[model samples]
Target chain A: MNRQNSNKNNDHRDDFPGSFRSNPFHVPDHYFDELPGRIKSRIEQDKSRKRLFYLRPVVQKALLAAAGLALLIGLAIALLHERNDVHVYIGQFNGISAPDIEATLLPSDLDEYTLVSFILETQDFTGMPSGTDITDEEIKSYLLETNNIEPLILHY
Target chain B: MHHSDEEIIPLIQDESTREKGFDRLVKAYQQEVYWLIRRMVIDHDDADDLTQDTFVKVWNNLDRFRGESALFTWIYRIATNEALAHLRKKRISFSFLALEKTSTAAIPEYNDAFYRSDNAMRQFQKALAELPDKQRLIFNMKYYDDLTYEQISEITGTSVGGLKATYHQAVKKIKKKLSLE
Candidate 1:
């Protein structure tokens, strides 16, 4: 039965349509061959509108909404990132443990297998965004932004 | 058939003969785009609307085209995208996403206006149409357009490995679809 099916499958290649499958498959050449002359008139009708290049107010509002959302997200990210970095700097400056921060504010687990765990755990993140209760993350970040790791320069 | 893209681009750059150059472009690519579109929409009037839109956009934006890739690839890209977008707007009756793009396009599945039934090709076209967009495009380019993998990559913005895999899968599926029929 399998052999018969295979033979049957092999037998079906003799058919094609539109002179396309029979002839060479020249798709572009084929399309152009049948394009109507009405297209010229349509192009002429829309030519002036093309030159306008003006966005309608509704389009402008949509673009503004998109831009606003993007900016807000960017600002939030920058703030969150700054806060996280500051917490890290404070941890480093005060001789706080990387392992402790990883346990608390910073997450260190990076495994593909842990994706579901991360997503499920993220549901708990809305209430408690920062794992640590330290406020004004920017100031702390500013103090610890230095490259040089001095001996215990954490200003508490 | 007309002046090459390289020849036409220069003329389009100049304001004087821009219209003439664009007309040549329309003539060159209209038929291929139309058929690809016709297969997708399965409706003549829809195909006609989309083909005109494709050329009109090309005409208006010819000057904006940077010559980083072959003009043919760029034009095919536009045509395929336009057709796909049109299909999406019209809604694809069949879907083959997780597999290849079109589970339907390998065999001849067109109707009486476009294709005849009882032909081996109809089965293949049907299988081709059933494929996902990727598989369909790969099958179309390789089987129909006879394009090289590298050329196809430039046109479809897919990797050569992906195209080859897709073509193999497409042919395999076509065989299966035809067998079932």
Candidate 2:
């Protein structure tokens, strides 16, 4: 063991003339010493890059999802409105009946109903209001008495 | 005392939390973030924009973080996705490949590969840009970020095996294109 140890020591003797060598333990002094401004600048640059790298997908998805949700709601509203408009119809006329018995004659005086039992459909195309709450017998008598002129044609 | 990335994330959850912890997290991880983005984007400005975008996302979604992955991995995922998205929107010219004898003669020479190559990094950037978007994302997460296939699988909703295949294929294509053995 002593002989082996001696040989090992002798072999290592030429490898290092002294225990302290400067080769492995050196760096430029300023390499470890940074000015505050420089360090701060490096830090800012770092933060800037990191911030961008971390937020990319989330920001994009947020904007895209918001736009998508808005479109969906808008489309729904538009579709509902279109559906509502599909079932409607409109008819225009000048008058109602009761004591008046105008029978929905047009404002333009296009025609008059000469028949006693012609239809008087509501504007909604449903049944009429039963001759505006007047009796049919009274309406007929009144029409006969006035020679079929409108009862409310006061000047006549 | 400085907080770890995990500690910093919760501070990013609220607007005020960001006010308190954002600068800290930025200071803490900026070098890793910058080089990662810089290497991927190639251009300094593009890197800058993408880096800022990464943080804003972190700030907004800090609350959603469930501690399932390391903070480093999570942020890396964001960065990779952003870099790929930016690349997708870029309209680099294919004119370099077009012949002068063709009508494309009037076009100028342009290639996405020119700016980024300083080392393997440039090739990595180009390879990343060339890949289909999701594959590029998977590559970035796998190669640079050092994320496991399982973590990437969850983040991207891809199967782990699929991600592995994508990463392997991407590596091969990049190697072939860049003439690496």
Candidate 3:
């Protein structure tokens, strides 16, 4: 099949007026002489380029990982400092009267809801009797003794 | 100086003789490779750059070349791909109308004393430059380079039948352009 095609192409070439196979282009004198040296230089340059090409991604990824680790460490340190501040502030209030501690530590502008939520979060209720175990009479007696009767009546 | 693939391959595979083998390879095939690219690009400078690029690829990939095909065939394949890629990039940078103008502009204007003597050859080159990149490639390989359709297929990764059709179309176009038909 290739032979047939080659023969056909030959016939096609015969139909042309002039030969196209002869190259009309000219190169500078000694172009071929210098080509090998130029190619060798190019190959050396390419080798250097490829070395940098392979190394660049590894360096970029290492830097990115290091940056990420630094950010996480920074966040953890900030969080630890914030927790320590809260602990030290509370520790300074030891032996102070409850009203005095509240007046000094809490802002006067704090809303009732915020104060209630804050007290609920900080107060320990582990040893307290369950609501189902408390009698109505006990609740009334505790409210009266604590002078919370007027507020309780108004809330009801 | 004129080393065949059989002699060249082993020397290139060895560490000590690799550069020498590569130099011999360049000397042996550089003109053919340059002309192959020159005809496609129509500019000597572009062809020179592409020829050097082709050899650089050959040097870099020689280690993985398992001698599956002839060395010239592999090298020709690389040159063909480089030429096509260069042409494609040129086309992309220009509008369709500008691409046509650029293709014609890329052809040297026959101002040289040698080129001025050959008006017919200049016309032939103009006709060839007017061809679409792949069609011109097929025509150049088949008509000018005297390559078999099978060899062209190996280089282009096109089926022989498809190459034959493209070659015929290219011939028809060139003939019409030259007033031969």
| TM-scores for the candidates | 0.55, 0.41, 0.64
Residue B23, model 3: lDDT of 88
Indicate the worst ten consecutive residues by lDDT in candidate 1 chain B.
B107-116
Model 2, span B49-168: residue lDDT tens: 677677767655767777677676677678777876787688432222233246432431212233223445444444445666667566655554455676677666689889878887
Which regions of candidate 2 are displaced past 4 Å?
A1-156, B1-3, B13-18, B66-69, B91-129, B178-181
* Root-mean-square deviation of candidate 1: 22.7
Pairs with backbone N, CA or C atoms under 3 Å apart (clashes), candidate 3 = none
For residues B64-84, write the lDDT of model 1, one tens digit per residue: 887777777777788888888
TM-score of chain B of each: 0.83, 0.64, 0.84
Q: Would you list the rank order by DockQ, best first?
A: 3, 1, 2
Better of 1 and 3 by TM-score: 3
Q: Cα deviation of A34 in candidate 2 (Å)?
A: 15
- Report, for every candidate in turn, its global Cα lDDT versus the true structure: 0.63, 0.55, 0.75
Which sections of candidate 1 miss by over 4 Å? A1-20, A23-36, A50-156, B94-110, B113-117
Score candidate 2 by DockQ. Answer: 0.02
- Docking outcome class, model 3: incorrect
Q: Which one is best on TM-score?
A: 3
> A74 in model 1: Cα distance from truth in Å?
47
Best by lDDT: 3
lDDT of 3 by residue, B41-156 (tens): 76688889999999999998988887787778899999999998998887723122454455544534233312544767656666777788889888887777778888888889
